[model samples]
Target: MKYKNPVISGFHPDPSICKVGENFFLVTSSFEYFPGIPIFQSKNLVNWEQIGHVLTREAQLPLKREHSFIPSQGIFAPTIRYHKGRFYVITTNITIRKTFYVWAEHPEGPWSDPIFIDGFRGYDPSLFFDDNDKVYITGASFPGAGPEGIFQAELDIDSGKMISESQFVWEGTGGSSPEGPHLYKINDWYYLLVAEGGTEYGHMVTIARSRKPYGPFESNPHNPILSNRSTKLPIQATGHADLIQASDGTWWAVFLGFRPVKSTKVHHLGRETNLAAVEWSEEGWPVIGENGRAKVEHDAKLLLVNEPTPWLERDDFNCESLATVWNFYRNPLESSWSLTEQQGFLTLYGQSCTLNDLESPTFVGRRQQHFNCEVSTLMEFSPTEEGEEAGLTVFMNENYHYDIAKMIQKGQTIILFRCRVGSLWKVVKEILYDEPSVVLKIKATDTSFTFSYATPTGEEKVIGSGETSLLSTQIAGGFTGLYFGLYATGNGKCSTAPAHFDYFQYVPGQE
Candidate 1:
């Protein structure tokens, strides 16, 4: 049996997994995107479903990143654990500089309000439950130590506060950025797994062990048991992993990795979740997928559990609320969008903001998982003001985005293609239109994206095409990937009406 490298695809990065009964639950980092920390559930490692988001409300994740953190600067990384009867998610809000913990009785939950882990500072927090029922939190930071390093502390789960002084535990395999630490007691020794070498080209997974939960940790002889930096593997930057024991007692790991565009170093879809098989050596060390290079396909069981389905690719705007897959850039204005107000349509009220502004503009998007795909939406928008515009976008961040909008010009509304890279903003193409309602579409490949709109006679004509590589992290310089969805804005002036989206669809191309 063979399974693909990225068992979970797209911008769902920084994966952390824990088992509960016969099910495996996982979570990933969601920087600056509201409804943060997506949660997934699986019966077998090969198939996963987005069960829900941990932070579902703006109050839970109040990202004031406009003046400080940008699109990819808010949430750092998260670690999930199952202990007692509750499931815990520990994460750091880089924008606010606070490490917090949230828990729920069920994986899909009304999770508890965050309790700041006071006195504990820094990022990539993880929880460890020892055999004695004691819990520990590990993070990449100094604990009043001689230098910045991975630290550990006993935690009171109920208060979400440290009960013991934090101590510097493992110094890593000397890889840069020693972070995303998780602790587990395998046999008689407790194992510490941490990702180092940063989160890019040199990213890797290293392990250390100690007799106790906190100290005398020795780095594994074969440190960095997983990584692709030294290989020609297409799955680059494979690290930040979490381990789980399946029902059959097979050990597996779930981590984040990116698949670059063919013949190019550019990967715009961002770091995605990849699954791998783990084998424990006789010396009590875990050896990862074939010399730390995972194959594109794998299967742990000769008997597969459930057949998998492609990620969500379409929405008819017929639901009561937004689907679990949709996300806003940051804190969207509370009253700006609705699904039920127009019945069978998603109405996005034009906000007084543009895509370039750090402020939250009216936008709702999904991750661009595949490079070659077709995304289209039927939008009925009548912009009454010059600055008001509504359409689709292949967005990276505020500074780097491309928009195909039906905007008000002079007094008439016209379909236009707006491209912005850093400080440059230009209208690449436009077509005069008497109708406000039009079907906007974007056909994208590894190299470029073609923006088009449907004519009155139902003919879809290309309005503009731009280099897709520009949105890559290598070019845009962000920790995020491509997000294609609907956008409506007024450029600081509010609109008189809302933009109505009847349906949205994305059809992935063949591999």
Candidate 2:
């Protein structure tokens, strides 16, 4: 069976997986976005559905501006593992420099509060349950900790304590930033897999093995078992992988990779989850993809499905709560947004904090899943105050974003198109409008994004457009990608009026 590379698409990075019975559960890193660590389930390797998020509450995942908030500074790499009957997810909160784990009976859960791992100081943690019922925690060593490598310690899962001193296991094959380590015990050998080369164009996955869980391990003769660096493949930056064995005794790998715009190394859709078949060598080493390279299309012999699970392209706000795809900028105040306040519409009260601020604002968004797609929203908002505004935005963090909104400028209602690139901020276009309701749209292409607006009467007009490269990771300098956001802000003062969104739609275009 042939399937696409990115089994799970868009801004979902640091892919990790764990199998229980016949079901597979996966997780990916969510940085600076509320409801962090999205959990997904799959029956077939090519098809996956988001069951829920591990960090759904503010208590479980606190993302606040006061903690020196920055883009790509909250949740890092996460590894999901199933032990006995309970599911465990361990990750790092880089903002607080803390490593913690949470557990639940089921993947879609009432997960327990974080059990902080004392004496463990690193990122990308993984849990290994040996045949003797003993649990071990392995993770990348903290930077400047003498030598960089993978560390391991005996863990008391109940108390989150390290029973033994942490020890360095394998230092990889000398690639930079040896992180995202996963340990597996296969046939009397403990194999250590880690991603190296800094997760950019040079990203790669390498492995080693030892008789014991801790050191005296030897690197794979074919080190960097998986990578796409310097290749012309559509999928690039391939690494940070997790391996799972199927019911048929076949091994597979789920990893993170990105699809750059044609002829350019710029990708704004972010690192996505990719699947590849794995086979063991005669020497008991694993070989991934086609000679360590991921493809845009690949083959798998598992029980194939007719089609992958479909995503909802249009949200009408008819449900009692926001869909699982929606995410806030940070820890959003409960009072700032509501679905029941104005039945059949998502109502967002304009908060004093604007999108430009590092603080939490009344903003809700989803990842940009396609290179060429259309995103639009029908919003009803009448701004009486000068700073009050509500509309659609293609956001790439505080300093890099493009906005098409209706605001009160110089005592007159106007439709504004603005761009913020680093230190440069400019109002590219604006038009006088007295309408209280309007539709704001953004049409994205491989190279640019076109902003337009339509009045209630249904006449659409092009406001302006901006270069898509402006929001690329190469220029923005962040681990996150672009987000299609619906935001309401007051710049500095709270607005008495509220914005109501009738519907939000994202339609992907054929390549």
Candidate 3:
């Protein structure tokens, strides 16, 4: 059985995992998406289902709806661990400059509110439970003094506080940015695994070992024991890894990597989740795959379920609340949208922020997981003011997104197509319409996004097409992937009008 790469797809990145009983649980970085820190459960490492989010309520998260977020801010990296019958997740919020942890009796749960670790600094936090039951926390950071390396301190899990002075453990294999530290006491040797080099082509996993928890450690002779940095494998930036041993005594590593668009080096889908098999060398070193490079296919015997879900592209909106797949840009103000009020439709009340504003602008979206795909939605909207409008968006971030909306231009209702990249903002296409409702569509082929609108008669025509490469991380300069979202805004002033979305559908394809 050959397990395919990207056991998890789309923008899910910075994966961390832990095992309990016969099950494995994982968590990933959310980075500005509300209901942050997606938690997943898997009986086998290959197939997973999102059980819930760690930060559900705003009181614990506090990413204000009206606030603007820069790229790669908000939630950074999360590490999950199960100890003494409790599940713990530790991570950082860059925008708030804080580190916190949440724990539950079970992997899926009504998790306890965040316990902020006072004076905890840096990012990519992890937890390690020693055999003696002494708990420790480590993170990537450069403090004011001492050599820069992974830092660690004894932690009081119950109080969410650091109990001991921090110390620098390992500097990694001298990679550009050594981060994502996970420590394990395996066979009496403390093994320290850290991802280094930047997160692109040079990303790699390096290891070190110390007899004591605090190390003047020895770097693995085969230093970067795992990486695809020098390979032609479809998975690139292979690092940021966590290890878990199964009840059967098998070892596996879960890491983050990206699947670039076919033949192109650019990837807009963002870093995704990948897995690899690990083996111990006679010298006690952990070797990844047969040749020390992450493999695209692993032995079928390792995974109980090797099937990955085909892209889920359609949502009916008839449910009482938004499904787990849909995510908001920031903390969504609960009063601005609803599903029960209209029944079978999502009504988004127009807010003051435009699509270009970092503040929440009555928008909700899902990841664009495929290069060749089509996303469309039926929207019923009536714009009474010039700046008031609502429709669909291909969003990368505040400054880099494409908007195809319905707006009022000089008292006439029309379909509008606008392009925004950095400081460039211009309406690329417009079409006048006599009707107040229309179905808007965006067909994303390998190279471009083709915008279209359909009439009541069910006929459709292309309104405009734009280069898809414009949304790539190389051009957009963000740590997030693309999201297809429904949006309504008044530019700056709030509008009373609402945009009713009949449904949103995404059809995956290839060319």
Candidate 4:
């Protein structure tokens, strides 16, 4: 089955893909979002499944304080490749302003700690290994060098290190601003593919070919092989591509595009992943899409064999380790979160005194996919002092978030819904309940959200409701999806009470 619009939709952007035998794997740059790069697998180019994130452990990629809260600025344009019995991925942390690489024997891995490359050289770095066992690293231009262009250098695969100094190979045709450069060898020619015209309205996939790995490559006559018809269409920003050939010799390319809701230009869902077919032309250039433009929909006949189970939505909490679906807001202290016994309850220990601070240590989260849904969790409390709160929240960045939480005030539980915009947090609703345990439920429809609570007798009452517009990336301005989660922290000690999450579910429909 082919997904017409989004094969892997909604903020799953800057797709880099590769095929090993009959199997295919795709990865996306996760920016500052922890559990860095998400690894997706697809048998056919159309359907994709989230295998896991490449950086589960902090050792894989070291994230600092400044880059942690802002998810968009940390990681950009990750390129994944499988070679010589190992999977290698090279990416740039624009915040840290450096490039690093990691490898694993398997795709869903215990990947090695990052091997930081030597120079503070490039951005959007990609790897290409030649047929004669020569390894090369190619990337887009950096600040000090020439104008926006593509550069290539030799590399040592084993050490994840660069061999010789890089040289400028292609300057792009006159006015074209080429970025996201990836190299491939085909039919005795090294083809350099790049995304030009910036990452905005005029974005496109252009190609230049050379007979040698490092040489004077010539641009294709039909410059843009794949692009949206820029003639007044709302959807724009359609480039930054990576290509792969299947076991059956079928070629495909994955790139990024943005479809705005109200406006024709800006993308609130961030850059979306798009797929297109490529064919080698008789004249030796690649012909992309069907008529040389990205097909707005997918071809059903080109679909492949297997289907993918995207991600694990439900957790029984009956395991010692946490599920891969959970990611910390910042790099986490592994000791801070754990499952109590082999039961269906997950416990988050308190670290930060308040949820409003960037240095807070509390881990609060839920996955970023799915549209309309409901999430509920129960917390048992034995608070000795005031200011200990535990509750549910919808978070975008540290600057924008809204939550409904219950805190202990002189042995009483106070439920309050608070929203944070910029640095201001205002209480929207408040209720005082004399209950030790209460169930908190948040129902999210297509446009708005409502919160309700129960007395454990299944008798529930509505507490607060508002526009879920806070979940938009436009207001928050980050390269990540909105997350809802359970949290606990602040000025008191919690003992003898287990935080229980009965179940979390998502049912599609407008209610």
Candidate 5:
């Protein structure tokens, strides 16, 4: 079977995988987005469906705080494991510097509240269940918190207590930020796999092994088992991998990597989940991908020939609840958005919060899965106040974003196109338009994003365009990717006006 890379695409990063019987469950970091740690299930390695999120409630993930929450500072990396008929997801909340694990009977949960692992520091925590029924937690040690390396400790799964003292294990093959550690008890050795080089262009996966769980381990002769560091491959930043063995006794690795736009090292869609074949060497060490590089496509013996699950592109907002694809910035106010306010339309009440605010604004969006895509929405908004605006935004973070909105400027209804890059903010275009409703569209290519608006009579006019590099991780300096968001904001004061979106259509262009 031939399959493409990024089995799971867009904003989904730091992939961790576990197998139960013939079903494979995987999870990825959701950083700052609500309902964190998206979980997916796959019968075969390539075809995956999102079962649900691990943190669906505010109690499990309190991303919003009294102090301003920085973007890309919430859930770091999550490792999902199945033990004794129960599923566990262990991860870190960097905002509060807490490492916790939640358990559920099924992948689609009713997950338990977080059981905080006190005295455990750092992130990317993974659980290893030994043949003797002992459980171990391995994670990357936080910088400046003693010896910098991978650490291990015996953990009581019931109470989330550390049964043994934290032991400094193997430091990776001399790479910066040796994180995303996963331990596997294979044959007679405890294999430790960790990602290094700081999750960027230099990112890599390295391995070490020891006879015992707590190591004094030896590094692999072929240290970086998987990486694309210096390569010209479309999929860059390859690392943060988790290995899983199939029912047919074949091994596979699920990792996080990003596709830069054309020749530039700017990826606006974020680090995506990719899969590669794994094989054991004659020396009993594991090898990944092709010569330590993940390719754009793979030919593997898959157990099932399932077609890739199609994404729901057009949302009419007639459902009782929002689709799982939609996400909020953080903990959203329930009253700020509604589906029943206007039947068959998604209505967003204008809040005092704006896109630039660290707080959660009246925003809902889906990930930009493809580089070449078209997103269009029909919105009915009458902004009486000067600051009240409602429209579409290609949002990367609070610091970097491009917006095209309808608002009232000096008592005249106008369409505004604005761009914000760091401290520099500019109004790219503004046009006077006295209309009750309008169609907003954004066409994205590898290099640029074009914005346009259409009147009720169906005449569309291009407003402005912004370079895709402006909202890229390299320029924005965030762990997140761009989101095609539908938003309503009142700048500083709450507005009584509401913005109702009749429908949202997202169509991906041919590669």
Candidate 6:
């Protein structure tokens, strides 16, 4: 028990929650991460456990190619719901534009392939079912000439088609940008809650209500039913919420929020999930936290998963599939990655001219959830000639990265730790690699990182160490977490130079 802010941590943005009996299921926008849209199961709305991912099969989504980096254009906000005996999820992949639907008899799904919702724009999509068995789907629109707010439309659940014309319900309060819509029926009114004011400093939650599913819904007299600032609190980015009811009949909201170490920067942890208690006033508007802005005591009874998950960095690469810790930067080709065939090693097939090039798209990485942790990998690479390189790196977007790599330059085997900080790639240090196989380790502590390397049978040596303070959100602005992964880039002339990773692990309190 003893739950505080962020029951779920690290890049878990735009949360959508649904209640099935006494259990609660939550999902979030996965962006370019592979096995998109992680589905989590919780009981008390606090501690959560990752049950599985909805977009596990590549055929579930239509990608531009077999292997590609979507670059901020993958799965966006997703809404999950249960109707009759089937569970349905409606969502959008910004790259795909069309809204899509998938369902299963059980939440842990053998989910049917996606059924595209013909026409829609903007990312966040929510599904609502009325007591009469009628269905409605709502979503936010990407910028265009039309009204920029949340839109709702009736849907035929069996066919995943919008029946009625979709329309905006509210223009949103001044200074707030409406997005991330969640619908619910409370008492005699239909409540529509959305995240507005962007996803940063001004982020907030707003609500509107109407007697019918689609209508001239009136704004809540006290809009922004729940937000960190409504309580004048310190947590930032208090938007993108999903609401559910507790077994005790108490209403609760689980939304994404972050507490930055400083106002100007964000640690690579991305957004952390926060919890709040909601209550309907006598007049019937929801009140958040304690008395409006009062600080509430930590509730221990809300813990969802009792067992703890072993940290990702500690995993021994001895599994058939990538660990829950690993996520591809974008959609991956199933043919390139393997764990079981390699026996004790995780093999990554080399692809692409550069990391951004779409063809050879295969990078297996893990989110940098902790600011200070150690990540290391053991691997080997065969460089056909100069310009071929494979190694382990701390990657932050396309513009920033640092790596400890092994390459054959002019037929001489060498190990180099280099960085592409800001604009240029600088070779910070270099050492002779007598063998093609080597081990690379990175220690990140308080924003500074150090790189070390070792021959397959030689002693380890510190190759390079530098300040990684710029690897923060303020410097490398994005709505994502820092990642560490195995990488290979060349002129695309080599047959195959695979990196065999004994394992990739993260350990805290290590030098």
Off by over 4 Å in 3: 65-70, 142-146, 309-311
lDDT of 2 by residue, 182-269 (tens): 9999999999999999989999999999999886899998988999998888999999999999998888999999889886679888
- Of 2 and 3, the candidate ahead on lDDT is 2
Per-residue lDDT over 1-511 for candidate 4, one digit per residue giving the tens place of the 0 to 100 score: 4455456766677899988876788888776567888898878877677788887776665566564544457678899998888898899977677798889989999888888888737888999988889999999888666656888889988787778888889987654667788999988889999888876667888899999888799999988887774645434567788888876677888888766544223334457777877888889998776666765575644556355454454556677766555667767656455676426677665554445555434665755444467777765544445667677877776677778877767767788887887656688888987677778878875566788887667787888776556556656677676677776676444323334454554433331
Q: Point out where model 4 deviates above 4 Å.
A: 66-71, 144-146, 173-177, 197-202, 229-236, 262-270, 290-296, 305-313, 353-355, 381-383, 466-470, 491-498
TM-score of each: 0.97, 0.98, 0.96, 0.87, 0.98, 0.91
Candidates 1 and 4 compared: the better one by TM-score is 1
Weakest ten-residue segment in model 3 by summed lDDT: 63-72
The collision pairs in model 5 are none
Evaluated at residue 318, the lDDT of candidate 2 is: 98
**What digit string (tens of lDDT, one per residue) describes model 5 on residues 1-511?**
7889899888999999998888899999988898788899988989898887899999999886445444578899999999999999999998778999999999999999999999998788999999998999999888888777899999999999999999998878889999999999899998999999998999999999989888789999988899898889999999999999998888999999999987676789999999999989989899899888999998777656578767678999999998888899988889999999899999998789889988888999989999999999999999888788999999998889999999987888899899999999999999999889999999999999999999867789999999999889988887998899999988888878999999999999997
Relative to the true structure, candidate 6 has a C-alpha RMSD (angstroms) of 3.1
Q: Model 6 compared with the native: what TM-score?
A: 0.91
Candidate 1 per-residue lDDT, tens place, 123-162, comes to 8999998888899999988344345668889999888879
Rank the candidate models, highest lDDT first: 5, 2, 1, 3, 6, 4
Across 1-511, the per-residue lDDT of candidate 3 in tens digits comes to: 7787787788999999998887889999998898899999899998989988888887767765343445667788899998888899899887787899998997768889889998767789899999998999998884553566798999988897788999888888788888899999999999999999988989999999999999888999887887888778878889899988987788888999887766568888889988888899888889766566876777856567745766567887989878887888888877678898788889998788877776777899998877789999999888888778898999998888888999877889899899998889889989988687799999997678999999656799888878777888878886888899998887778878888898999998863
* C-alpha local distance difference test of each model: 0.86, 0.90, 0.85, 0.73, 0.91, 0.74
Q: How would the candidate models be sorted by TM-score, starting from the highest?
A: 2, 5, 1, 3, 6, 4
Candidate with better TM-score, 2 vs 4: 2
List, residue by residue over 16-130, the lDDT tens digit for candidate 6: 8888888888888776677788889877776678888888777776545342233456687888898888878888876666679899888778889998887665568889999
Clash numbers, per candidate:
3, 0, 1, 1, 0, 5
Runs of candidate 2 exceeding 4 Å displacement: 67-70
